[model samples]
Target: MDHNINTKTEEETITSTSIHQESKLLGSNKSSYKQILAIGGGKGGVGKTLVTANFAITLARAGAKVTLVDLDLGGANLHTCLGVEMSSRTLSDVFSSDIENIEDLCAPTIVPNLQLISGAHDSLNAANLPHAQKQKLIQRLQQLKSDYVILDLGAGTSFNTLDFFIAADVGILVVLPEPTSIENAYRFIKSAFYRKLKNIEHQLDARELVDKIVEKKEELGIKTPADLLSAIENESSDLGGKVRLAMNEMNLKLVVNQTRTGTDAEIGFGVKNVCKKYFGINVDYLGNLEYDSAVWQSVRRRKPLAVEFPTNPLVATMQKMVGHIVAEQAEKIKNEKSYE
Candidate 1:
């Protein structure tokens, strides 16, 4: 569960075994791994599902095999957004041992090249599982054979939500222009930062320092992760360097949703700069999605917005965000190859 790409020693074995088995399943070499795109927000009704459904459709249309997962363990409605009925075997099947593997629960959506993995019902206690079950699920997710796996995470910074978000190759934090949403978004990032620091390279001393900083936020007037980092560096520069490297390795992206005015559109950039200055973390502002009535109309009809209104402005924004992600992933793969 190390936050940076190096992962934990145990995780290295998991990856090697996963690639070996899954690559044989797909009859392909382990030359590339599937891209995982996850969308999470601090609160509900912030368009996390909407963005996820359309984003998956866009990538699938580009001929990439994609799977949209409803990781909203408490409340799973991604099926509703995709206009697909519930599968006979949902995540509950896996939780109940009715299904041996999560991939067995895969069901097709209306869109070609895309599949859906329905969420587990809260009644099944899928949201808060024993540690063994959670680890098994995480490993299974790594072996999913798809070009992309889009996870629509539930709201808030719950441990389950935060772990899935952290596991994603491209984790997106969505927020609205409203004050409540913005505040929650900031909280979400802060919680994620602490969680990440707590796990990175198993540095307990640095993690303890982070805990103290967070606990003293009110008294010390620390508003950003960067401010907290400065305090740690003042205590010990060596620990601060490790923290900096860990934070820099994380690629937490942001998107402002349901924006109406020009001011609303610019809010993402503002938040990005603030995070950079105070958090000492670089946030990629993938741009904002403007408010469009057609979005609701499509959701009402239970069709993806991209399918219903391909020419909508919001769709264009989704396209641009996808393009950025593809480019970023390509660059990342290229660098990995160069190092190899």
Candidate 2:
């Protein structure tokens, strides 16, 4: 994909920020200070792990400490992607008495400021991780000392995946330019949005209301989250307002990978628009990764694209996306402080 494309330039507004201040604020001892970025997709082989590994490298190279967590569960290979030997101290160790802290599993990588917590030692049923264990893992991840934590999530909309995706400060969904991929991407978003709503339905005292609305959404003419909120408002405006706030608070992003053409690169914007219209969610299109044979060559060499092919055009695109993410995150922090 040509980054020089006029359309690409018009679509992306890359922002700049001070990495020193970002590191100072985000790398604090407080777990809440850490920034969590979860990369997931509905279908497999959409380059989720590739994005996670490269993005972590980009951040680390930018002077921020980064950790890559292989939450892909039963099928973990992030270690292989980064050319790191699989460590004995994997996430599976956490389930046993031998390991008490998640940080104890951190393994160094070729990159200076990047660490990894591999999931390679997990059991076949690791994908079906117990809820309590998953929650504990998420908390520990937040408590990690790294300035940035990138989760390489498993494909599908399993409850575990949805919960982890929702737990992150930023949720990014990877998609390909095809019908099947697009459909699954939509399914993943819908599942995640409802999962979030379900978690807070009890708090809003609208469990039955939400269930009824979703069940009869077709009959009730509710097509989007906004439509459902309008229906709830008819019954109780206060509950509707709270639910609306929850919806607005969702931070999600879009990235189209393996783009072979300009139309493929444009898929991100199309997905973003569909999401806004169908789910009433604002998904930031974080640019695209053009299809490159070098990606596969790097994989065969067991190295991250950024490290193996430093001059690759795809690396430049990845850098642009990371810049936008950092700038937006910094702005978010500034806005929150003003409110405080």
Candidate 3:
């Protein structure tokens, strides 16, 4: 990958020479194109967007063509993080007017091999984009050509967000160690599971079982998946089987961010335990990121944490998590290809 080029400027030399050397040294390998990863959080202010942007840049720096899409329609700060000013054309223009191709709105970022598609800037339109338009946007994303497409999703359990999260090849939920964030994260996982079950309700007694679970939420105190499964099994075996299949096929991962101590690191373990004991969901605790001042400083400078502090502890943690996710996904793709 390292091809010496004639460059004079210091920036050009660093970008061309150093990055190529690093990519080669890291043994970065390419895979068949078309991978989508969505970074989401149930609660805001957990560094979801920041991590998304940096991780995209990191992948790009490793010689993969990456597209970092800002899907946080109401609050689009991804462009700012990438040091790109508001472009004339955005997803808003595509949705509201005569735009033939969604790729027309893609704007190049400062980082080579990385591009961004800004979301609608108009608060009213962004917040109220019809379901059809949202579906169209996702379809466009699916057609994008790149090794990886990382989506920075908005905080909430709205249908739009949940749909995007489920659509991703890998759905990473970023959470802090606080009690409220943990509670919200659990709720988000449960909601996503229920949503997935609803989508496949045509299979046997899935619909009825799900309805019973929802109707008796107060009666069953269904705070965990185990409780929900027990209730489902008691109510209907067919529905329970469907739910079990969905849970087994789930591709969800968790990342505990802003870790301050050993206790904070234990959050991921606790979540995994709760998920296994209660929901029958075996969530992979991908990794934990340490609290770093450099993260906040990079935000102030409108730069990604990975870019600003490439060797920082948090960046190392994120890179390790990304590696695990990528390897697992690559294995799945290879198996699929073999079956084909």
Best by TM-score: 2
By lDDT, is 2 or 3 better?
2
Best by lDDT: 2
* RMSD list, candidates in order: 8.9, 4.8, 6.0
Task: Tell me how far the alpha carbon of residue 94 in candidate 1 is from the true structure, in angstroms, after superposition.
Answer: 2.4
TM for candidate 1 is 0.84
Clash pairs of candidate 1?
Answer: none
Collision pairs in model 2: none
- CA displacement after TM-score superposition, residue 70 of candidate 2 (Å): 0.3
Q: Least accurate stretch of 10 residues (summed lDDT) in model 2?
A: 2-11
Each candidate's number of clashing pairs is: 0, 0, 4
Using Cα atoms with residue i matched to residue i, what is each candidate's TM-score against the true structure?
A: 0.84, 0.90, 0.83
Candidate numbers, best TM-score first, in rank order: 2, 1, 3
lDDT of 3 by residue, 147-250 (tens): 78898988888887887887787888999999999998888887887777676676554776677677989888887667777778778776677777666565
Better of 2 and 3 by TM-score: 2
